[model samples]
Target chain A: MLRTVLTAAIALAPMAASAAEVVSAVLRIERERPAPISRLELPAGDEGFMGALLATRDNETTGGFLGHTYVLHKAAALPEDATAALDDLIEQGARFIVTLAEADDLLALADHAAGRDVLLLNVSAPDDRLRGVDCRANVLHATPSRRMLADGLAQYLLWKRWDRWALVHGSHPRDREKAEALRAAARRFGARIVSELAFEDTGGARRSDTGHVLVQRQIPGLMQGLREHDVVVVADESQVFGVHMPYRGWTARPVAGDAGLRATAWHPAHEGFGATQLQRRFEALAGRRMTDLDYEAWVALRAVSEAVTRTDTADLATVLAHLLSDDFELAAFKGMPLSFRPWSRQLRQAVILGDGFTVVSISPQEEFLHQRTRLDTLGVDEAESACPL
Target chain B: MRGFLAGAVALLALGPVAAWAQVVFVTNEKGNSVTRIDVATLEVIDTVPVGQRPRGITISNDGRQLFVAASDDDTVQVFDPETMRLIHTLPSGPDPEQFVLHPSGNPLFIANEDDNLVTVVDVVTRRALAEIPVGIEPEGMGISPDGRVLVNTSETTNMAHFIDTETFKIFHNTLVDSRPRVAEFTRDGSLLFVSAEIGGTVSVIDPASGEIVHTIRFAVPGVTPEALQPVGVRVTADGSRVFVALGPANRVAVVDGRTFEVKNYLLVGQRVWQLAFTPDERYLFTTNGNSNDVSVIDVAAERVIKSIPVGDQPWGVVVSPN
Candidate 1:
């Protein structure tokens, strides 16, 4: 009789099986690059712009605990397919989408993921607009915001007593946003921008075809009438002319912008609390040191793991509620805990100032440090966020 | 006069002239300081600042010099053991992480991780005599009993590369696990132990054949692999007991040397990295790198009888030869 009853129950178990907890994720690599290129110094896929996104998936899921099995789906993106690709990810049962793209791609993904119970995690792109007026509820930024990066630079500048600055801007939207963010931070921290200069896109190689002749022709006049400033802050996020600006075009003063004192989510030498272990593991598995994009994606996956463990469920609503709540704190490789902005849902974090191989310092060196809590210093704080739930 | 000279030599051979094991050298990783402790009175003698990020330390065979590998500075610093003064600095090639002295006391072999090479430095000349390529991320180093072979463990390749000291060539590479950090051979040359920080186990390999003979697994439920990391392992002189330091687990596992079984565990401070033994083998000292304290264990009782606070991030420790 018991066997007959068990067989009947097993036959009627479709509804319960469907309700069993499961989480689906989509890893989207929205990058535009030529065929993968190899520099002699690095590996085959090391130098390509697209490889940064492809390498991100290498850090996603491990240990396989909490009944969570993540599925990653890859999509190659040009500049145009940002919106439709993110929508396709949501339709394919991905409650979370991690993207490696720029400001325009993030804006499109933010709209697509909004109100859909799907979180769009941006691993690349450091435009302040995404964390400011353009911030959204469904979008969760894994990378440190542009404002945080600027703040970090400003703190070091203030510490070094570089109280005067000359701001230079480039043609791209990324450059404009970075300059504006730096300007706002300087205004708040009492560092004055003495002068401003703008560089044309020129549309070709990074270096001037005319070379030193062109730089000698243009820079003296642009910087001719300037007063004594401590440093020159150049915003060339497009990498078009940031390298050219240093030691060649600019004046004799030291530059502290994209080229000299860069602010980013991660650096190889930022050996803080868990960074050594994470970096060691990343190097072991990925066969190379981790970059900023890879680090952000890893943190996004960690946030997912933490939420799943805390909520004890993979259901979209439950996980979203926990992530939005104030009690969430993520212990990342940054040596400090991170949390979310209640309004914008951007994860608050510090940006490390990088000089290529080494990290010079972290922002908010404990003075301009303003926070509703420590996590609020990353992006727009809870009290000031304009994002609507 | 001849009889008096022989008597004085006998007295000198019998013991130290005075009680001179007063200061223990505690190597600091981040603070860049070497703490000195008076073990007899349990007082911190002095915290002397040193070169950047010193990790491993070894007292000279004569006990007159202490060599510390300041990794960040890429040099080995020599200090007067009696005066505690920075007497001399020796270039250890690029990124020297650990060092092991030759038994004959003529040269020092350094494991340079950044260059992936082991540098043999002439003690008197203080110059690198030879550089031999090893595995990737070469860290812990040990010399064989016969002093003819040296073993260096690479963390990334997870292998023990045996270097022939005479030829300065890699004899063999024995793969152990995910991240093998350190390797040490038993005094009798019977067993070689390699610690895999990520693998959560130490592998015992036979030096002659480069074969893993035994695997010792360490684990505690609910604690992650990051916590149960086994870093430093030292065997007693009589080969009766083996002590292994578990990184964040904050405990040292005392294993039965003959049976290869864990006998008991002694709780220590946090993030235990390097450990040492008194020359008499009666007490074991562990440098708790995170807690800034050195835990002194009574080996016979298998308990940490005392904890002495030291410099910031106390890392490596070595007993004085005298």
Candidate 2:
């Protein structure tokens, strides 16, 4: 259906000879790599890259009326060194670049484009260091940081009066960082971390003929002697063993964090506050449910489009200025006007807490209040941010 | 003094004869019932159980039938107003949230929140006439006084889809604030007001051009912006006053229709969802969802006169025309 509409729109495009200025956006995505676990299904298509394309279409829908047109340039399968890719897009008159890269690569790209007249939007990484000590003036983060996601889940857990948590983590660097975020959230929300355990990632095939029996016995034994806790929090972004801990725990407790009732930027089951429309549009365009990375990429591109349309300027400096100003706010169907925090340049948004099939709740719960904005209560606030910019 | 004495004597002579007995119907979403209130006596006369999750309620053009959108049941239950009994059920689309009747009294436009379609059903035939494809999660429905144009607000899309009544085609889509829940037109049909629940503002749109002319924002002294969610909108018959229900703030903001400035905020019950006016426009009723009651506001006095307890989660309200 979306293809038919686009084809019809293209067929009718030449009839309107209005001289509309064109706004160009470039998306740079990393090449697909094999997952650590063979059991995990790979996404059928590029997640964040497809989201940028759909957002460009959405931008054109409104931009067409404002004497503006949008053009998207896709740079897929880019190598680790994004310098050449950035230079190529910059040479092609692309002022806005949406980067779907890891934290280190994103920082490198940001530094490479620092003195240039371009803005880079980070849409994939959720590293706290990027929003804190290594924050960049030219780079804005659309995805929520690890701390924000942890705080969002912790707020709900506290609201449910589940103050004691049993922390479990995998043997990975990213998992350790995520566990640290959970620890910080526990301290911030007055929750007690009663027990901490680590599961070693033994090198083996994730699935075997008799793996379920081993997992059923091993998971229960791993959690047998834990102290009494209200909830079991797992930090396993590597998808190692968290999936086995949900129904296999010995105490029959609810799981949270990276598994079970998880907090994410977007969920496919979210239909409240008009999110159903977005889900329908995404499915129509991408032929699948939108993932969290897709939503972040859409938000990044939409932020650029919003600034351009509001200011009526394609000038990079002017658009960036408008985006960073206090007056700029983007309505991305999160039930509130989403804006960026000036201190860290992190977009403030509501996080969804879901139980795989349906959305259980949204963060920034009624009890967690902030002086300036309630959304700021979810992540590192301006007062605590280490970024000098 | 002589004029005052004459007015006092006239009031005594008129008595209850001048007061009209109005019936206000409030739909309780969670309780699946409708509470009928007698305006003159200020009492809940009867509570009729209808269907599962009744949200939107309205009266027919002739005032003979009352329509309530039973969202969960996927039907719009029709009731005889005089007898307060279910007469028939119209096949509404899935998850019908709100609906509006055409001024010509033939077709009803219903917003299906889950299906992303607007189901147009014939009132008398009780059959669907047309189902128009709209933006996602269509919730609010408004028809022009002349019935030439119909507007549906999609909550997630944040766009007010202006549908041509004659063609049943979307002529224009105007983007409003976040989570637009209600759309209302002025008496003259020149201006349209869309309340965005999460955007915290009411956008005054120019219906013809599909452009937002002005935005009305509410700011109470102690109320936070997150809690000041604008949901239901009601414009007076004369188009002089516009009332907006602030969802969690528990207040109704009265806006000067012509000047586009907020005049006053009348306190109501918790989590007000929808509003309706009496036939004479003398009083306005608000369904407070959290408090599970209906608040009666004397329009002339601009104050809440009474709070009558009703069913659980009172969502939508409509008064009889006669």
Every model: Cα RMSD to truth: 14.4, 7.1
TM-scores of all candidate predictions against the true structure? 0.57, 0.83
Q: Residue by residue across B32-122, what tens digits does model 2's lDDT show?
A: 9999887777788778889998999999866788999998788899998756678998888777889999998879999987666788888
Best candidate, lDDT: 2
DockQ of 1: 0.03
Q: What is the TM-score of chain A alone in each candidate?
A: 0.81, 0.92
* Model 2, span A1-389: residue lDDT tens: 11222111111111122344544555554755436444445666678877887888777765654456788887754656578888888888777788878787888888888899888888888899999999998899999999999999999999999999999998988899999999999999999999999988876666678888888888988899899999999999988888788889989899999889999999999976557667777898899889997898889888887777666667778888888888677777676678989899999999999987899999989788889988988888888889988
Clashing pairs in 2: A274-B156
lDDT by residue for model 1 over B1-322, one digit each (tens)?
Answer: 2432443465577686654554578898877988876666656667778999888898887788899999888799999876668989886886787789988886898888765567788878777777766644578898887898888886543568777777776657675654566788888988888887756678988899878888988755444434567889998877788899987788898888777787777789998888888777778889897788999998888989899988788888987864
Interface C-alpha RMSD per candidate, 1 decimal: 25.1, 7.1
Candidate 1 Cα misplacement greater than 4 A, ranges: A1-62, A65-67, A208-213, A216-221, A249-251, A374-379, B1-23, B30-36, B40-322
TM for candidate 1 is 0.57
The regions of model 2 sitting more than 4 angstroms off are A1-42, A86-94, A250-252, B1-57, B65-99, B106-179, B188-192, B204-214, B257-263, B290-293, B305-314
